[model samples]
Target chain A: MSLSIFLITLAFIILLQAAIPFLLKRSIAFGVTIPEQHMKERALSSYKRFYSATILITGTLALTVYLLWAKNRTLSEDQVVFAGLAIQFGVLFLSMIMYLYFHVKTTKLKRTHKWGAGLKQVRIADLASHAKDEMLPSYMFALPALITAGLLVYTASQYSQLPAMIPTHWDIAGQPDAFSRKTPFSTISLLLILLVIQGMMFGINVMTKRSGIKLTSAKKKASQIQQLAFRKYSSWFLFLTTVLITILFGFIQLVIIQGGMGNAAFMAAMPLGFLLIMLIVTAIYAFRVGQGGSRIKVTVEDEEAMETAFVDDDQYWKAGIFYVNKNDPSIFVEKRFGVGWSINFGNPIGYIFLLVSILLIVLISFFS
Target chain B: MLIQIETSSDIPIYTQLSNQLIELIARGQLKGGDVLPSVRSLASDLGVNMHTVNKSYHELESKGIIRIVPKSGAVINPSIRDGISDEHRLRIVEELKPIIAEAIVLGMTAKEIQHLASSILSDMKEE
Candidate 1:
């Protein structure tokens, strides 16, 4: 396969990634979850219009760029790949901007009507008594780490068998494109990557756990249960991902030494497999439980206690997304209407953490 | 030691915290010398402002229900009647006056009012 083939696949992957978030956002229309039931239709219509317009503009821009690039046969494969990637990414960036814009509008509309405005913050009595239940799922990452270690030993056992130059990069059609020296680092780089990914996922899991839940007074118990469920579900998701990555990378390592780079058909399918798994899981949970998993109907259906349940407290959210509450000391809190956790921008520690995280990411990028 | 507070209640958050702490203390759920959580930690747990938690702690301290040892955590004070000054007695009566008046206005019979307070006591015991 040529560079063009890889580029095409990458563009498609990016497009799908963008669409998944949009799909979750679309669930608000069903009133099965989010911003309470009454105001959902309004949000739905406004968001639908916003999304449609953004998609139209983004598609046109991408298609124009692709056609323009198609007509120019002088461009090298690298240029074609670069052009395709840029077009897809540009579309994503534009759509995100539009998404935030509409989010701000919806937030303002929610505020105007005073939706969920009367719900009080629920406080836990004897905070220390029940705090032990919020245990970190660190063991989840450990499982993958242990698997990687086992694989590392297996790879090292074949140290004498690996070729002088091992295949490092593959083409879309499963052909080796770039080669690297068969040193421990080169042969084991895939494992190292897996380890780094595991660490990042674990860190995120811990951070999300620390991010406190947001719930109203009447629904405090139900909300707490939901938050715990969501956390449990997320950790399991992380663990599953680690196991999958371990198997994939472990297989890749074995294939490189055992069957040769040309035999690595799995390499081409790995990305597609990962994306499919992630999309399927996300779709199932997001639809079933909704954002923060707060609207989950399973145990949260206590009728008498749900009078104050969860209100769409989107008013305090700056731009209808970033929660800004000076009174809240938590650095992180579950997002009001999104699937993931959001930082409490109102807290100084949150800004510091965000800055540090960005710096760490930059350093990692440079070192890697 | 469960202390639940409602933020939107007309009652202040600190009052809610203090009232629940008092209830726990009275019910023996919080025994003498039982250490309460630090202001910062409690605030973080409940997602409330530090001052709000501090206020609650201070309120408990002022009532002689808890002792805030310097550099140490707040501890429940032994509920000994060291001697009730007339002013303290008056204050207690003043606190109870509103409840009695509200119950009377609601047309609750004296026996029913007693039953209501007893039900609350019984419920607190269950927790």
Candidate 2:
């Protein structure tokens, strides 16, 4: 089971890397903005093909080598896990390098060709979109917190019957590898961490609601519909993931509280199931909705009027990845190269958010 | 309602924003009591400086087209039926004076100007 999981994870990573080009907004290719008319250029298609083929070939070769090592049984289970991680990171690094290569090549090509020179450059905002009842209500997230609280109460009531030492670490086989003296803190720590994570999830939902909707001028009405749909579906995805994570953590807490009495395979399967569900759901969401709802289908009546070029602000995007615009007050903007939003590094609020998240992770780790 | 900003336009960003918003209001697309997006929200949505959107909101408020409530947001004011005040009428004439002069210099007839104004008015009411 572990071997299969490792192989499946590696395959997923490689495919996802190759699929990155497809997942980006149609206006953006390899982190560079392309005019609608230039998107179908032969050179661009060849570049995309070369990038994907290179990543696939290199990643598959590495995975095959790892498979051979794993099958030889010369390496321990821990080494097998580490080797799988190394391979995944190796592929990821290769893909990043290739992406930058294409980004530079595309930028150079666009510069020489003047892809959108003649078109009017414009940005659009929909005032009424904010008023739309699109987001999942904040109160809905409170359900998971309520469940955690219930578990906390149960833990308190059963404190006397709990083991003196509780498992704090588990191995691949679900055997307890480390333990800490049972105290009220250790007993309820996981529940507390779960609560904090759930709160963060709630915060993310609120941020999504307030994040600016960037409409593509190439298809104003269609882009508007797509943005709304993107916001709606992404928020729902977040809420559902929050619920699933809360349940997974709750199960772990229950097992720890009960002195690790659950079956070994079941215990191991819980987290694996959580990861599998999350990956599958995210892949499906990205495929269906796309970055900024670029994949969503919509029709507009006056296509000619909306044919303005998407404003070329490539200067703001450093390497087609990090967005650093001092003049742009937006805290979050849709990423140019990938799915979902990225922080505007020029905004001080982005740094504050990053620091707070790091602090939360530290707190969770310290307590655990 | 959608408000578009042309970065390369000769008009400043804030003026463009205020102009488009006023046009929306004049067309009744943004009705009385409708709350405009907050400065930060609109600025971020248009990817411009917050001061730009703030300037536009203040311009609208100065023109009495909207009232900015500190907490809630900028709300469109109900249209008043009373004819323009003398000062306001004079200000309108001062603003239109240059455009009318230019039209005349460009060989546009007075009747053609009247027809243009009426056509624009009808176009607004059409929607």
Candidate 3:
């Protein structure tokens, strides 16, 4: 594949990864109660997304530059390759800046008396206040994503001006430019546009999380239906991104190989493999999303019951105490300590190990 | 030291820490004036928030089981004073009355329960 083509492909993949989290965040934000801990989790996930994108864009750009220098005898002196690299690096650098900014802001918010005090108070109003502050970091985080999308669209526009093929009318060199031409913009724009949409989705999520009012009895059923629809939408979003990338890459490879080498056989095998992988991943993700959504529903129900009881007893002062009632079987005894309380679902040591593994993957990809 | 926290258990973490430490002290496993791990260190090691550990330390301090200096860390109390007044003894009995009643209902004779209590005390002394 040409260096330009490879860079465009990788950019799309990174964009897909970026978009997935935004969609997931939106679904979660809209469907569940926005606890302080959930906000922290969202921030952490955004960091992961930023880290992944940095690794991907850096690795692809480096490889593309090397390939252009070594393999492309005709386009070796082309400034387009260098310009593309500069744009990619600019995006990567901006992403890092945004990541750092969000990280610092979140850490400050976490340590500050106001955020900590509100969480401790655990009132509906207090949580809403914290959620509002949480949105500030997200807005800061989205800046880099926006910048990358703009640069990508510009790069794609420039690339479109290049002739369909250098030597032939339909073929670029000996390779057909079918896939590149079929998509008017480079794949990079496809990915970035998706990312921009993802950003808007995350905004919706933040709104849902921050809204403090309970769903009225009439709205409860509708809300449940909405939650289910959102969950399905998120699942399909991830599935479609995976499928689209797989098909686009496969098509590009086929176009590069030019129509003679058993195209039908390769085409048949590729989509089957893609579908298998997509199904497996989508199943796991869907299950997790469903489980998390149900848990949120139960929590919301409990909160409603507690609110009603508190009002009846006129125990306004005790309402924010956040005590686990003695009769509540669902309250975990150890989680009351308030630390490592967010690390749930199994042994703490194992959970920490998984988190470390994810961080190591990001670091490895970043430096490689 | 290994600390296990079962979130689903009825006992709160701080109470669990207190009871476990008290049991350890009663059995002479933790010596007087021995330094306990700093709150932050222990909290991170145990994958908990520092506030949780701080609450446990405060409880221990109030019971004179440990002394927490602002920056110097926690230390086991040097003296185990036997300062239970008569009123305090009555208060202790008052707390135990419900448990004793439950035990009686569970089919233990007075002599048997007394004998069992003595044996447990002897076991503690041996440890």
Candidate 4:
């Protein structure tokens, strides 16, 4: 439960995930149109390679840390090292399962349209129609990572005060401390939450991909559900953590006032201040994430008429002539209709900037 | 001669290729009876689907612009001496009438429209 180990694991996962998009981009650059049948195969194969490399490196590092911490230490007969290993293995298995599920779902969607049919004449209008469908599964694929990260954070915190070796006692009722009292419950809760989140994300992915435009109406309902979930989780976390910190602070103040102005108060206050700052930062980030979720661009074009329209739900920007006027065929009828293309906040450049910023932050964290 | 195909353009690849060939012929850049690349060879060279190049050759052949010989290659056809038939001319004029009306609607006077047409024709002749 060392802080360094947790940070190292986080760094490994983020770096590996970041490289996935870059690899896909490289394949596209090489003029290899990953055919529908092979898209998942190629992606999974690449992911396996990345996962193996990461596991090998991180596993060695973790083993070294364990050896250093638990040197010459022997656990009692009931003490088990297998619980942590089981959780890690379970998370990995679930990630693979989620990946396969999405791959199959996206493959099925592509097959329904037939090979090359959608891309053959590929008008801008076709892209507009297909954008929503294509993007739906991406969020699903991201679900496993989100679930795993959440589970890991919860597990880390729950097991933070545990010694390097597990205790021999099996009875929670006879345990000496609160940490030992709820150990089994905490572990079981973590696993169940992971499973539920992963399953829900997969279900949402499949349902949305199948429902397509029907999901747009459902999306509004889903958003309300999501907001509720956010509020529920954040408030619960804040309330519990706030209570725990306040109690800890009160204990420190009692000791400090008795001992007469000492370092204990500063130590207690430091973490409280740090927690408040983290909550504020997380709130800002969550707001930005919500803002980014709602908008998507749609490109429309007519190849025959040589016209193009870039539209979203709220606004439409069209360029080129839709038709030559019958009364004035000699004069081309053109309309450059859009509120303001430049003013649109949700452009491709913004996505690129966000991606780069995330990468920069992850890299900086690694070095730090 | 190499004819590039722009797949992402609004115009179909076949039409683009055919137009380029026609323009080359009209400018005497490709002379009558000159040999052209085989469809498969041209398609491979241009990194296009073979069917695309085949369609372009077919369109050119149908228009009497190029003659395709089996296993030999395509060759430019001799220019036609006679002008379009009276029926065809009338059909073209019928299509132009609406365009003329459109020009009038766009604030072009009849004389101005006529002048513009003549100038375009003269420019084409120079090409």
Candidate 5:
């Protein structure tokens, strides 16, 4: 059952990867910014087909190997899982290689054509676009935080009831594989970690709400609607993830406090169920609202001058993926290729936040 | 209001920003007490330097079209509250002097210039 679940997860990931060419902003192809009219070029469509075929074939081969290896009775479950993970990572690495190859080809084509040259490169911004209004209310995040805090307080009150050796780690079969002496801090440590992670999600929510909305210049009103809808859906998705994670951790905490006495299959299934829900939500949101809301339909007349295209600031995007602009004060911008935001590499604050997050994770792991 | 800046235009980006904003206000799309986005947000959205947005905001403030409160950002001032001052009148003539001179040099009659101005005025007033 676990293997089947893993296979399904892997298939979903591969499907998403193969759909990238169709999922990206209409102006962007293979990480290269192109004129809107050039999107229908024969060469571009052929490249997309080749990319998808390569990814699908590679993914199928890797899954087959994983299934064959797992069915062998000699290996333990942990070893089988590790091998599956390694195969998954290998597939991901190859997909990156495929993407880079096509990225280079598209960039070359764009250069040879001089797509946006000698045009009035313009950017449109709606002065009335309110960041705070585009997001879910801040109070919605408080429920999970409140639950975590309540759990922490309850665990403290029942500290004496916990077993001397508290279960700190559970394996794939949901058996307690690791334990730590039940000090007051160790008893409530998982709750603390949960709170910290919830806080991080809240921080990201704040960042998304604060970031400026970037609109396509051709149809200002239509683009504004799309941008706002994208923000709204993404914010809701983030909130759902946070709440789901909080509930899972809360469940785990309750089982731990009860001396890790739970049904083995159910315990193992909890996380798998969470993963499935998250994947389904992500697929729905991505398809409904493509990267930068490119999939959303909003009609405006094509009355803007043909020469006036969106500002061709492609020079700042490294390989059309990494955005490094020294002048942009924004720390978070919508990703050029993906569903959500990417950090501005030129901003020192991005590095600072990243380092802090890593340190926090390490510290939490150490304490627990 | 959609504010667009043409990077290849002869006019400076800051001037274009301010002019578009003024046009929006004239069209009644932005009214008194309307707040503009902050300089950092606007600049990043437009992919321009923050200083450019700041310059444009200051230009609006100088013309008494908006008030830049330190923490709250720029807000449009009530246009009916203040009559045109002599300083503003003089500055307008100074700015348009070269344009009118070019029109005359190009052999435009006084009546034709008046006709052009009235047509533009009517266009702006249209809903």
Candidate 6:
């Protein structure tokens, strides 16, 4: 792959990734699970249709902007990649503003609808004893650890062949932008990142498996099944990301070793493409399934529950967004208006975690 | 065991929690030595205040339905199976007094009230 090809591919991959959560929001009816009777109504409703249309329109505009930007044949390959990335981010920002406005409006609209009213009383359900055991093979958790160890060993064994000075960093166009002596500290940053990410993923999986799941009820069995499926999907997401990280790191190691057999660009493309394709696929899956298996079909349990008993928790939901119920000791809860989870700002520990996490991210970005 | 807390009930949250937990023990859904979820966990699960759950746990401990060990979470007491005392009998009667009065006010026959009590007991027994 040439530099131009890589840049365009990377741009599209990122735009797609950024667009996914919004796309998935359309499939979901205000971030709640799809009840069988409400399935068509939810899908066909103006909220979903408008959101879907907006996503399509935003995506088309983003691509057109990229194509038009790419027309600047006078620009260097590096400039092209940089410009493409900037455009994606700009387009994504606009799309996000549109989503936030419409998403809040849609959520409020849902409150007046029967399906929304009936799906209230959102409570967490305990994980069935078998859920964790059944979701994925236990061995899958060890894959990242094993791969990391293997890569470390392999890199160490090739140290003799590695040049005294190695390229520590590369620009977006597969060209070396920074160099350092062939030391573990210089070349092993990616490995460290991978390990940290793996640890985080492990923590997440354990938490999900042990913690109670949020359910829109009257369908206990189906909801439990859906929770389990979501857990399974989460595992796959972790596995794929781990694989991508390993490839990119391994690619770096190869560049440091044999200089990629004189096909640097081509060698980089394989792993980069693999990573991008995985991201695109994951985004598509998220779009179709929504968060926490919202769109997965199962037999709707006929048993009726107090579905109409909507908890008037708006006060607890601080600023109508961040959940700040000091009484709720849970560290995490399903996000009220989006796919995935949010940390409870109520629990003292949870509050601390949120603050520390934000601080760490900011500090890292600034220093890096 | 499945335990439910009615969020919309007029009764106080702690009182409702204690009552439901006691009922669970009565029906054998929660057995002797069966550990309940930690106070924090249950409060989080029910989306209620932790102090409310703490109060409920204390109430159960006072009644001898569940024990709150220093480090361990609440556990149902084996002594829950022990027969009631004269005090307990008096307490039960005292608790039922208002309802009995209401039944009388509503013009329900004594036989009908007796049947209602019997039906509830039978349902609990089946569980």
lDDT of 2 by residue, B27-125 (tens): 989899989999988987888999999999999999888999989999999887888778778888999999999999999999999999999999999
After the best TM-score superposition of candidate 3, give how far the Cα of residue A243 lies from its true spot, in angstroms.
44
Query: What is the full ranking by lDDT, best candidate first?
Result: 2, 5, 1, 6, 3, 4
Across A1-368, the per-residue lDDT of candidate 3 in tens digits comes to 23545455446544533333343332122112223333455555665566556656665666566556546555543454565566556655655464456445544544453332332211111111222222233354344455445545554555545445321112323332343333433334334334544444344333332222212122233334333443344434443543355344435333323434435445545544555565455544443443223322333332232221100101211221132232111111111111101122222433454455556545533332
| Residue lDDT tens for model 1, B54-123 | 9989888877789999987899988776787687688899999998999899898999989988998898
lDDT per residue for candidate 5 within A231-294, as digits (tens), equals 8998899999999999899999989887747777888889889999999999999899998787
Q: Model 4 off-target regions past 4 Å?
A: A1-368, B1-13, B41-52, B80-112, B115-127
- The clash count of every prediction, one per candidate, is 1, 0, 4, 4, 0, 0
lDDT of 3 by residue, B33-116 (tens): 777766644553343456777899898887667998777788888654777668657867997899889899999899988998
lDDT for each candidate structure: 0.65, 0.84, 0.44, 0.41, 0.83, 0.61
lDDT per residue as tens, model 6, A1-368:
33455455645544453444444423244444333455566434665556556656766666666666667566776676676666656665665665567556655555556444444344433422243434455456667777777777877787677777777566555667766666665555555555665655555555444334544445556656665676567666666776676766666666666754636576456666875677576665666555566667778664665545433455566433477767666666655554455666766665564465456545543333
Residue pairs in candidate 3 whose N, alpha carbon or C atoms collide under 3 angstroms: A332-B7, A333-B7, A334-B7, A339-B49
lDDT of 2 by residue, A86-139 (tens): 888899899999999989899989989988988877988989767773879888
Quality of model 6 by C-alpha lDDT = 0.61
- The parts of candidate 6 lying over 4 Å away from their true place are A1-44, A68-72, A107-143, A146-162, A181-184, A254-263, A305-307, A311-321, A347-368, B68-72, B78-82, B102-109
DockQ of model 3 vs. true complex? 0.02
Tens-digit lDDT track for model 1 on A32-51?
A: 22444453465566565556
Clashing pairs in 4: A125-A301, A327-B102, A328-B102, A329-B102
Runs in model 2 with CA error above 4 Å? Answer: A299-302, B106-112
What's the CA error at residue A221 for candidate 3, in Å? Answer: 50
* Residue pairs that clash (backbone atoms under 3 angstroms), model 1: A125-B3
For the record, the alpha-carbon RMSD of candidate 6 to the native fold, in angstroms, is 4.8
Which consecutive 10 residues in model 5 chain B have the weakest lDDT in total? B78-87
Per-prediction DockQ comes to 0.43, 0.83, 0.02, 0.02, 0.72, 0.35
- Across all candidates, the chain A TM-score values are 0.70, 0.94, 0.30, 0.25, 0.94, 0.74
lDDT (tens digit, per residue) of candidate 4 on B1-127 = 3343444568887788778788777766677887776664444334345687789888888766788887678988887678876875787799789999999899999889889988866765685
Could you give candidate 4's fraction of true interface contacts?
0.00
Leading candidate by TM-score? 2
